[model samples]
Target: MKTYDEKHIRNIVLLGAAKSGKTTLCETMLFEAGIISRRGTVEEGNTVSDYHDVEHERGSSVYATCLHTEWRDYKINIIDTPGLEDFIGEIISSIRVCDTALLLLNAQHGVEVGTEQIWDYVDKYQKPTILAVNQLDTEQANFSRTVEEARRVFGSAVTVMQYPVDQGPGFNSVIDLLKMTMYRFPENGGKPEKLPIPDSEKEQAERLHNELVEKAAENDDTLMEQYFEKGSLDEDEMRQGLKIGMLKHHVFPVFCLSALHNMGSGRLMGFIDNVAPAAIDMPAEQAEDGSPIPCDPSASPVLFVFKTLQEPHIGRLSFFKVLAGEIKAGVELYSEKGNTVERLNQLFITDGRNRHPAEVLRAGDIGCTLKLKNTLTNHTLLADKQSGKQVKPIGFPTPKVRVAIEATNKADDEKLSEVLAELHMEDPTLEIEYNRELKQVILHGQGDLHLALTKWRLLNIYKMHVEFLPAKIPYRETIRKHAAATYRHKKQSGGAGQFGEVFITIEPYYDGMPPYREHPVRETEEIALNWGGKLVFNNCIVGGAIEARFLPSILKGVMEKMQEGPLTGSYVRDIRVSVYDGKMHPVDSNDISFKIAGMMAFRDAFHQAAPQLLEPVFDIDITAADTMAGDVMSELQSRRSIITGMDSQNGYQVIKARTPQAELDKLYAALRNVTQGKAKIKAVFAEYAPVPPELQKKLSEEYKGAELVA
Candidate 1:
């Protein structure tokens, strides 16, 4: 490998819907660049980008793969990303670092749900894009319809740059509208031969060529004047205008390709090398404080780790892009996250599983380093503390689905925890949490497929078998009215027998207000209960019915009962205990006796206080097509959801609703089916509300049954 300046390096990412030929296009690109002697097919599972064992089994890419090739003295770094919505985290991370996104659209299906989902990210990053309508040789291929759909979905910025000469079955060549020439490839489809356009297709080619020239001219005032004065501009002038248009997102060139047959890919790569923007062409990197960091090889070294992987033999692989200066092996870099110096021991250029050693990587180049002490994904590394800068991290989407997990073998519990921790470090999107209130170990991820792959990895890679179960909802218990009860504790087990009597009143606590009662103000303290709400203790024992020193013991006993409520064994909250009257024996009423007395009295009062169960509710925001809005709302209503509001945004209906957490367990899957996998939904905890009496009765009975079985 040879070092190239920023201008000679091009960083591009391949993005599209699943099965849209992203992996096949990458294989063809590698073969066309002469980096590999032969190309591998997806069915064989031997492509350079999809080399992992799981990818082979699934016949699709599950992780982003880094690969590069040299063509005509220019080095192009390509990030091949997975297309499934389950692996969108990889797509987002890869797009964050690339200067250009080459979106591949299937000619048969055109702009699909997956394509729209990824386009959102591309638009978010504001990356210049080139659309390639692939799979032209398929039986249902329709290049014209795909282009029309692209224009409709992406606006008028999309312009046709190439048209297939003959599509389906006999697709063999394409007409380059920019060059106004026919590119005819051989039967085996290697290097295309440039030839004059046939008379039968000359008229349509000329019309498309004129449209291309006019679009190019509209990008620049000077080019527009040149076109107006001379009726047309030259190829160089048109390319210059197109570059400006692409940078400003005013132009999106569409090309035709059959990646499986290796036709028209060479020309696409040539155009990418010649016209696509370079890393230096993108906006300068920014620090956390919104200051620009120049991309200069002589300046201080700065690198941003965009992706991290756990390779079997190589350990942790940190993929990073050089933002400024140059990085070499044995260089000490400072990480703001660790606040310690880390020495880079080796730098390697990766192509899937293959690693090519490189001595130095210049600014604007992407490479990988093995085993950084503290550098993880999204961490920035600088040459010195004096630089004192960090790259803004990628904003990953929150997990939408979750499941409770338990180790199949009880002895592997600790091992599961350790492995889950390591996996979180490798991929931050996979979240593992122990819900203390619910008493379950929960694993959160993007969707069911994301969690399925994670479980497979745990069982196959780490040999830790685990079972997935439904996550328990963290319901709460509370009282609705005031009630009073009395309990006496008396034991005659020997000398110093326990004897204590307590009279306690229970009421619903609200916003730091003391219970409505008359009490002496001598000693009053507010105790913040751990289970939310407050406990106000007033030492109104004017006559010393119970000693003042025993107040703390009574409060402790109340808190202990709050941990496990009298109804369904859930945590209790928002309740005030008023111990206005009690009897105590001076010799026998110790802390233990008063505590037992307090617990019994509170339990009796709680039963008569109209106890209720409260379930958690979540705020849900759904974005779907207008045609599906009615169906979505109806389904939500069936799940006990309340429609809060609705509006229109970006050609889709934006719906806001509130529903119980338990109702949303399978809502995502249902939404996908209703919208044909085009809906985007987000949910967050809102508030807790009282459960219906019938449902509460069912839950109580289930709890009692479980206790009996135990």
Candidate 2:
């Protein structure tokens, strides 16, 4: 392989819905570029991108695979991404580093739910995009309907660059609208001979070509003036105008493709090399301080890792893009993330699982290295430590599903944590947390399929047996009103005696509430609970009824009871405790005696204070196809969800509601079934609300108390 300058490198990410032929398109691109001797099909499980065992099992891409091709004078770096929205993490991470997104559309299905979901990210990032209508040879291919649907969803920016002359089983040619010619392919479809537009299609081709010319000229004043003067744009002028339009996100050129037949890939690659914005053409990457770091091979060296992978026997592979300067084999880089100085012993240009060793990679180029000690995804490595430069990392999406997982063999529990940690590093969306309050190891991910894939890898690849369990919700306990109770602790041992008495008034705590009026307050400590809300501890002791030194022990006892709530052994929050009076024996009243008396008094008052249980509530937004809107709504209502808003977006229904955290799992399953897996969902934490009386009673009864139950 050879190194390409920043301007000569073109990085593109293939994106679309499942079975939209993203992997096929990648393989076809490699074949067209002469990088591969033969093309591999997704059905044969030999495609470069979907090379993972899980992907082969599912017959789709589960992880984003990096591949490269050298065509003409440019080195095009390709990142083929998974199409399933469940693997959105791969798509997002790929999008974060790519210069352009080549989005494929299955010809039979015009605009799918997956396309709409991915469009949100592409639009958010404003990456230059080229939409390709693939599978033109399929029997049900409808190019016109697909174009109209794309225009409806993506607005007027969709400009057609080429159209299939005849779609369906016998499709063999496309009219190049921009070049004003026809490309007739041979039976096998590698290179096509350029021919003049036939008279039968001239009228329709001329009309579409005029639209393309105007769309291209609308981007720049110079091109618009030239179009107005000459009533047209030359081939070079049109390419320049379209490039500007693409960089501004004003135009998305559409092309016709049949990746399975190996048609239209060469044309698409030609357009990419000629017009698509390279990394240097797009906005420069920002440093930690929000300053742009331009791509320059001669500048100080810097690289940003966007993805990482762990090969079973072969250590780890970190894929990164050089943002400034160049990186060579055997170069040492400093990672500020963990302050580890890593040596890049080997540099390779990756093609699926295959790695081609390269001596050097210039700026704006994507490459991989092996055996980085501490660097992982989103970590930035620099050549100089005193440079004080750390590139900003990509913000990964939040997990939608939560489940408790443990090793099937109890002995592998510690090893399980270590493996999960490593998995989380490679894929940021897979989050793991050991919740002390619940005493469970929780795994959070995109959905059931996402978590199941993780489990499969843990079993097959890591040889660690694990099982998924139901995760528990973090419910809170609080009181509603004020109540007073007094308790005495007296323990008479053979050698010594312990005696103490405490009187405490417990009430619900809220912000901006006045101090206790039952007794003159001497001191107060407003402590915030670790779970949620606050705990107000008031010391109203006066006239030396209780020693000041003993007050600390009393507060400590109150905290222990709050940690394990008096109602259901959950964390108690938002409460006020005022210790007004207590009796302490001069000889026997020690810290232990006062602590026990204080805990018992708080518990006695809590029972009389009308305790309530609060459960987590989430603001959930669900996007489903139009036909499944009613069914989706009905399913939500069944879970006692309150519908907040409903609207339409790009031919889909957007439903917003507030639902209990306990119902999320069931709701997701129901939505998947009713919508046939076409719904997109996102959930965010909202304020906690009290559970129903029956549910509260059931939960309280189910909780097995440890010490203070009797």
Candidate 3:
């Protein structure tokens, strides 16, 4: 291995829809560069990028794989990312650290749902992109139609640099418009013979060449003048102009490739090596405070960990991109997130499963180190004294779908927690939370496949069997009217007697609007209840029927009862307790006596005050194709959703709605089925609304039946 300057390093991420030849293209690139002896196929399960056991079993990439190759004095660091939406986190993390995104499109299906999904990220990050219409060797490949689709969907900036001479089944050569030449490959398709353009295709080639020149010249004023004067640009001038256009996102050069058959990949790699933007060409990396951090090898070292992986035998592997200076083995690095310093003992550049020892990783290069105790994904690592400056963290999408999971064997409870913690470190997008109110362990993720794969890892890797169930909704109980009740707790045993009487009035509570009582003295004591509401106790007892010391005891009893509402065991909220009258026994009316009496009284009053169940509601933003927006809206209405608004966004219909959490249990699946898997949905907690009377009665009955069975 050799050290290369930031200008000589091209950090590229391969992105596309699943089964679109991303992994295969990466394999072919590695072989073409002579990094590997031979190419591996996804069907054979021997590709370098998709090396994980889960990937081999599924014949798809489940995680992003890092691989590098040396071509023509350039070191290309390629990140092959999974195209499945479930693993979108991997794509996001990879794109954050790379300088360019090579979006591979299946020639058979020019622009697919997955391709559109990834294109959004590329646009979000504003990365310089190159579109490679792959699978040109397939029987149904149509280069012209694919190009037209690309222009229509992506825009006219998608100008072709090469066109397949004979596509579909017999695809063997490509005409390079930039050089006005033809690259004719042999039957095996390794190295191509560069030849002059044929007389028959010269006119079409000239027309495309003129279009390419115009697109490139638009990036720079000087290039535009030269193009207008000469009506064209030479090869070197075109490459330079295209690089600037790519950096400015003014032009995206499209190439033709059949990755499986190794056709046109060599030429594609050459184009990338020559014209793709380098790390230094990218805008300066931003610090947390929105300041630029220049890529300088002489500056203090700062590395950003974007991904972490757990190998079966090699402990934890922390993948990072050096933002400043160079990092060497045995250097002490400080982590602001972990607030701990650890020595980097070993540095390794990985090619999927294979690890190559590297002496140093310079600025703007990506590498991995073994067993970073305090360093995890999204953590910024810097020199010991460099504390104030930190790289901005990657903003990952929030998990939309969630499920309740529990160990099949109760004995694996501790093991389940431990394994989940490990898995969370590996994939930070997998959120594990214990809902105390709901009494369920919820696992949140991008989709069902994301959670399903996590369960597979738990059972297969961790050897812990688990069950997935629908997560329990955290419903709340509240009162709608004022009411009063009394309860007397009396226990006359042989030794001692427990005697207490409580009279309490309950009313619906609204913040900033206290109960209207004559001569109201600002609430004697205000208690913030845990169940999403407040409890204001009014000590309105003018005559000393109960001791003031018993006030705290009574409030405690009310809180305990609020934890489990009388109707359906849900938490109670937004209620005021007015202990206007009560009686107590001086000998037995202690904290315990008042507490029991207050609990009984509040429970009795809550039932009589028109208690109603309030279910959680979420604001949902759905992005679907325009044609399916009506169907989506209708489906949402069936789920009891209130359509708040609708608009168009980026050619997709954006529907904003508020729906109960319980009704959205299977909304992700339904939306996918309705929209033909081309829709994206996001949901966030909005507010709590009263459940319908019929549904509330049904829930109460179900709870009662369960209690009786128990």
Candidate 4:
């Protein structure tokens, strides 16, 4: 409830796999700082961070939550993020706005697939990080083995700054390796007591301390010289050097803590204040124009909206990070994407769903405000109109599953579009689109639960009720070989007579045609028809057989036919129709006559040639425990996934495969079951491939059944 200066601020993000005690660690940190009188457990659904209704029901974090605490004259703004792959976007957004990431690992599980999954994001951002081996009070806790696992997974750069005094049953205290001091906790409650390292583990602690000292010495020439000359460096100099290495990500300090029991929390807090880097110390964000802007408190205003939420009472709330300069309430800012200017009615720092009014926001600080027009997630706000620059947004993973939504009430259909648009603006990862050919409103997200949750939020928060079912996959039908056909359109209405004849050859479009070679006539309006593998029309009517004036009408007709496939009523693609010969009456052969003739000729030729349907495929990445790898592989095989390769990482297995999108629409829960909730997978749309003969028969049967019902 108090404002602090930049130097006194420590922006930290809690990141790890699900059930890794991130929420518990956040509660522990807050309680220890005396910010809260007592700690709240996840099981009780009373934690300050995981406060969402859905999070409470599931007993896991579903969205990123922000909170601040004062510890030892420092303001630590902690952002706790979801650990499941479905909500990984929340984790990335949180990391982007923080100075350091506190990666939590379950002591019993050691390093998990989720830990390995998020490490890549941290590495990509080059953000400084500290490892906390949590759940140390659990029955199977092993501090030494977890440290070794971290080293093996994260390389030798991971060094232990503190070690637990005991394992599993006897876990009570930690020894600060850098300061050569042991801090033991009270059996009941209160501050830790200073004590000497036990004789049994003194030698092992000394060896680990030497390794940390050597790593610190490598950071500076003077420190290395001191170590070489006296075989040891001064404690103060070593601490300073270690901080430098850790901030640069050359060294990642590992600390042991039982966040549930409040053990080792004090020492963890000490390491954060003494080691974590400030926002100004890290690199500043750049604009889309590739110009690096300094994160000075007085620089030009540049803010990025990292998250958005649809609240029942507040309407829409947007959370943003000020990349440069100070932003005050009621200031006018320009949106680079919208090319429109808007003012901040009021500004606030957000904690969970709660918003606290703040007068101004400085660089490197994250905050939010009420309704702003033309501003959405991933949009950049600028101080003035002249800068005309925007900050590049972080990349969000693509949705893996799609579900079609239908309005519950017939009158709600029109309103559904507007509501879905607002919801999509709130969560960029939730994609909504109207597939014209399929006549369905498609909603896509990370998985079935993600899609279902989106629909739930739309109804609950936005007051739009809808029904969800499997989305219709847009399959393409095309001919395999060249075939020629002819058709004639004739109509007689009173005095006017309509007559037209079209003779065309249909062929498949070849891939990889040079851009210059395509549409040599209309260079400005050249389309990538070949790239989409769609139908193409070429007019080569010599001696004016069809007349140049009728070309447009004929092309229009061919497009109409492409929408209505020759066999299964699916959209047609990858074919070329050549209007080489045709006859038309100048007065009677209008657009309608040519259109009818073109459609008939194209369809006849398509059916004569070998027609086939194309289905969507996805590239999948699966990360699971070594014990579950075999079961996961078998499951993938059952889903018709073709394993491309396999590898082991930190005692876990990673399987890369490709499978039909339809087969993977509901695999999230099955994967969780097979891996015992230890597996995480990410999937993206690859390309459409031909359906196998047996499966094609099944799909054809379904297509026919859908037609009969229609």
Candidate 5:
């Protein structure tokens, strides 16, 4: 790989919604730059960026792929990111390392939900962005409609840098408004043909050109005055005005292209080369101490590891973006995470799956290092001790859904955690959690597909067969009334017999109120609530009803009964049990005897008291486009959700409600379908609420029905 000067390098990211032809755009750029012999299609699954087997099988990118291309004396390092909202982490990482985000919009689809999502990210990062209307050769391509949608959704800051001469099947050329000439592509894959603007599109092109000039003029008073007075400006003046607007985020130049057909690609390349900002123009990342490291090429090294790939034989491959200074092979850098100094080996510049050797990678360049110790994604690497500051990690969306997984084979059980740990390192959005109580390992991610990919990687790469199951809801049992009880244990199995006596009561507990019984209780009070009634125990055993050494065993027995609730067999809660009176034999009354006595006494008391099963409720935040607000509200109502309130979020209507967790098992897909793929919802486990009588009965019956299956 040949290194280019800092000024000549343009770190760009191609980000958009799924199936927006982002991969095709990268392929076209590579082909146009003479890097590829022919363009690869997504249908054929031979694209350079979507080289991964999972991506080809799914027909969408799962991870960001880095590709470098030379266009018109400028080096454009393009990072093609996955467009699915579930895989949005890739987009965030790619956008953070790039100076410009080329948001590719399918001309036919116009502004999609994923487009809105990426736009939000760009707005948050305050990065310079350009809109490229792709698929101009498609039958349904509408450039004007797409441009209008961009202006409507993204605001008036979006301006046209070039106007398409014709759209759809006739899209063979585009007229550069700034240069005032037409460039048409010939059938052969070679340089485009320059020609005069056709009379047919002259009026529309002129109107768009004037609008662009007006937008650029607003950024500068001199340019505005010149544009208004003379009705035109020279190339230098226009470029200056556009640059000011783009840097200030006032102008997002829109370009037209057919990435699949290789039409209008050269023109788009020229625009990126001339208009895209360099590292100097982008915002300099600051450390936690609020000090900015001059992002200049000569400044000290400050690199961020945005990605980590675990290769089978070669170990870990850490990819990072250099924000300041040039980095050479065998350089020592301080790792902020580990708080230790580490040395880099040979640097690898990436192009799809291929890695080219580079002696030194300059600032604003993205490269990989092989086998870095203790380096993980989102870790920072600083040059020396003085400027040892870390760049904050880019924010990613939290995983909303989870699935409990176990090894399908007993042999793979021990290696499951180890394999999942490596997968989690590769994708930070994935979370692996172990529920000790349930004895289940749960994997959490953005959606089902995200979890599926994680499992796929585990089985294919790590050779681990895993079984996926729905995570069990942690439920508890509590009581409503109070009652008292007593029990005695006597076992003569052999020479050492077991003898112990326990007296306790079960009672319902209120959070801030006194016990339900409100009776003057004795020292030993065991209160158990089964089916909503409380059992209270009072034993005034003067001397030694229970042995002092067996108190732990008595409590252990009581806890065992609590877990095996009286009514529903669920874990019991809010019940107070006290050991006030008991009897014991000197040698026979051991921990075992006391434990058995305590367990029996608690169970007996709990059954006497009433206990009930409590189900978990979740607070849901549903945000949908205005078009689907009514449908979402209706769906929530169907799920028996309590409507809390509603509001607006970034043009989408947000509905906050509370619903049962059981109703949300397969709701991810249902919500997507109802909202036409524009709604986003998040639900968190809230406080437990009592199930209705009828619903509780129905659920109990269903549980019994499932018992037959088991």
Candidate 6:
């Protein structure tokens, strides 16, 4: 395979809202470059980029696909990413590795919710971007409105490089401001015919062209002086100025396209080839400690794995970008994460499902290798293990929804967990957690659709049938007021008798509370409970009332009760238990008898105490567009949420609230419906607050019924 230097390789990711023609654009690029003889439509499921079976089933892209095209003298590596927010992990990891983002804006609908969702990452990474307003051949296409909305959302850097001579169904001509010519396409739409601008459109064309010239010159002092002295910048000079503006994120050039009809794509690719910043042109990547790693092909090899997939016939394929130096098929590399050495037996440049064998890949080039054991997405492998230089990893968002998953067959339980772990390796957003307290295996993810797709993969790909269940909330049990109890355990058979008696007083535990005054606390131990809160066990028995040796057994029995509270099978926390007095028969008062006495006494006292249930609560911060803010706030109120604050940022409403965990399911579903899935929500653990009295009554009744069934 032929290898290109960093200057000749362009890594661009296609980002947009779903159905915004990204895959079509990729297919069109490949076709126009002669990489593919024919173009495939997304509806037919024949597009090379969206090759995953799941994507075909859903009729949309789910995974980020990598493809390449040799346009003119440059090999443009295209990473086609899914547009849905549920699959944001794929988009983010792709963004981290690519040098430029080719964002597509649907001409029919101005700036969409999904576009805003993706813009957050693009703006954060400061990647050089080129916006393509696509589907202009449609009747509802409004190119000017789309560009106007782009400027509003993304700021003044949105510079127009091309505008359609006519919009709507008859749109077939575009006036190129950079070249000062009009491109009139054939009826079928392939290469276009260049012609002089018609007098009807000449005036408006010159106005826009001058605006473009000023935008390009505004970025560089030298270019500005040249433009002011000569009244214009040449084509090459404009390219240089725009390249600088792109590198500094001060210019995001916009172009027009009908990717499906194969119009305007060639010009788009030409601009990308001549003006976009290559990896070599971009700033050096920074290490975790802020040290720069220049893109030097001769340096020691280092590659950061960005995405991986388990191809059914090909096993595991790991995709990465070489940060420095070159990698051969048989090269050996070491990962600092596990200090394990792995050999790259084979390497290939990928175009969706097909792979072409490659001898070597240089810096800034992306490729895939098969059968890597220790490397994973976001992991870096270095040729020199002792370099001790680690690249910063991609930051995946915190999981927003959680559900417990169980295997339909008990015997497949272990295999199910193993498969989920494998899937987690492929997609880091799918988190698996074995919540021991709830005795359920929980899957945490970005949304319901994400988890649903995970389940679909398990059943279809792995052939392991699994079902999702509502996760049980981890409620805590504690008391409100003080109460005392006494009980005697005695068992007399034919021989030895078990006999013991004890007294205990339990009150709600608070920090810095005075010790029990009825009797001295001889020995006290405060234990931090694993669930949460604390348990203070005090031995206040008078001298010789209960032997010191029997204290541990009593405490053990008390802990057992705390572990499984009497009111409900929940962990009890934040309560002080005082063992004031007890009687024991010398012969029958064994550890077993004292344990029974302590367990019975604690249960008796807990009945008298004002037991209450505490439910887990979460703090949620939501950012919604003005159009959906009222609906979002209304839905939040319906979920028993307490609004804490509201503010405005970037023309979006930011609302903060606290709500119980039990209401999270309702909140998630309601927010999606009310906001049309455009609002952003982040939830985190806040604290445990008392459950309402009526809800507490309902929970107790349900628990009792469950206990009866069990």
lDDT of 6 by residue, 74-135 (tens): 98999999989999999999999999999999999988999999999998999999999999
- Write one digit per residue (lDDT tens) for candidate 1, span 154-267: 889898999998899888889999888899988878798999999999999999999999999999999999999999989999888888888989899998898988898888
**Of candidates 2 and 1, the better by lDDT:** 2
Q: Model 5 over residues 360-393: C-alpha lDDT tens digits? A: 8888788898888888899999886676687877
TM-score of each: 0.95, 0.97, 0.97, 0.90, 0.90, 0.97
Error of 4 at 148 (Å): 1.6
Q: Model 1: which residue pairs collide?
A: none
Candidate 4 runs further than 4 Å off: 353-356, 493-497, 509-531, 534-551, 578-589, 618-633, 641-658, 666-672, 677-686, 697-709
Q: lDDT of candidate 5?
A: 0.80
lDDT of 2 by residue, 265-293 (tens): 99899899999999989988999899888
lDDT of 6 at 409: 100
- After superposition on all C-alphas, the RMSD of every candidate to the true structure, in Å, is 2.2, 1.9, 1.8, 3.9, 3.9, 1.6
- What do the candidate models score in CA lDDT, each in turn? 0.88, 0.92, 0.89, 0.80, 0.80, 0.91
Q: In candidate 5, which residue ranges exceed 4 Å CA deviation? A: 188-190, 220-233, 339-341, 385-388, 515-553, 560-571, 578-580, 638-640, 648-651, 692-710
- The clash count for each model shown is 0, 0, 0, 1, 33, 0
What RMSD value applies to candidate 2?
1.9
Q: Which stretches of candidate 3 lie over 4 Å from their true place?
A: 512-514, 518-522
* lDDT by residue (tens digit), candidate 3, 215-289: 888889999999989988888889999999899887889998888888888888888899999888889899999
Better of 4 and 6 by TM-score: 6
Candidate 6 segments whose C-alpha is farther than 4 A from its true place: 492-497
What's the residue-level lDDT of 161 in candidate 4?
85
| TM-score of structure candidate 6 | 0.97
TM-score of model number 3: 0.97
